[model samples]
Target: QQQVKQSPQSLIVQKGGISIINCAYENTAFDYFPWYQQFPGKGPALLIAIRPDVSEKKEGRFTISFNKSAKQFSLHIMDSQPGDSATYFCAATGNQGGKLIFGQGTELSVKP
Candidate 1:
């Protein structure tokens, strides 16, 4: 089990609203969890991450809530803004391979 699947292929949220996306994985061996944010024509950058050891992790307006037992995780954006519109990806990596398995991709748009 080394695959992670994400949903909603795309999402639209009003400015100052909350944006939520979900993801699930099958590999329990994964130890590293990370989210990447990418803008149009730009490479994805590490936005935030959480390990199975922690139930949740947050940074600024970005938050990652994870459920290890359920093999699921989600990303939440608070006070979403037009500037925050971008493609979000959920990924996981095991100690054996530093390489990350990413979700298909989720496009988030915050309308002003």
Candidate 2:
């Protein structure tokens, strides 16, 4: 079965702190990993993405650290803010018709 397991169903971070979310995958067919951020009453948006070729990718305060050998990846939010309070999801998809598998999801709350 193809699936991604995510940790910390809910997280609480202080403003200006770092928020970390972890995920692991079971499908080797997956070649692409993407993180999505969803605000209340809004659909999820692509926050960042990574491939097996890279160990890490950073865009502004959002960074994705990947471990291909271990089949794991993580998202780090630097300088966490209340505005960042949203549900985060880790997903994976491969060349097999581009079927995407999503993790359980993590609801992150940034407290001021």
Root-mean-square deviation of every model: 0.7, 0.7
Model 2: CA > 4 A from native: none
- Worst lDDT run of 10 residues, candidate 1, spans 91-100
Could you tell me every candidate's TM-score relative to the true structure?
A: 0.97, 0.97
Enumerate residue pairs that collide in model 1.
none
**Candidate 1 C-alpha lDDT tens digits along 1-112:** 7789998899999999999989999999988889999999999999999999999998999999999999999999999999989999999999775899999889999999
Deviation (Å) of 13 in candidate 2: 0.3
**Candidates' lDDT values, in order?**
0.93, 0.95
Over 4 Å off, model 1? none
State the TM-score for model 1: 0.97
Instruction: Report how far off residue 38 is in candidate 1 (Å).
Output: 0.5
For residues 1-112, could you state the per-residue lDDT of candidate 2 as single tens digits?
A: 5879999899999999999999999788899999999999999999999999999999999999999889999999999999999999999998778777999999999999
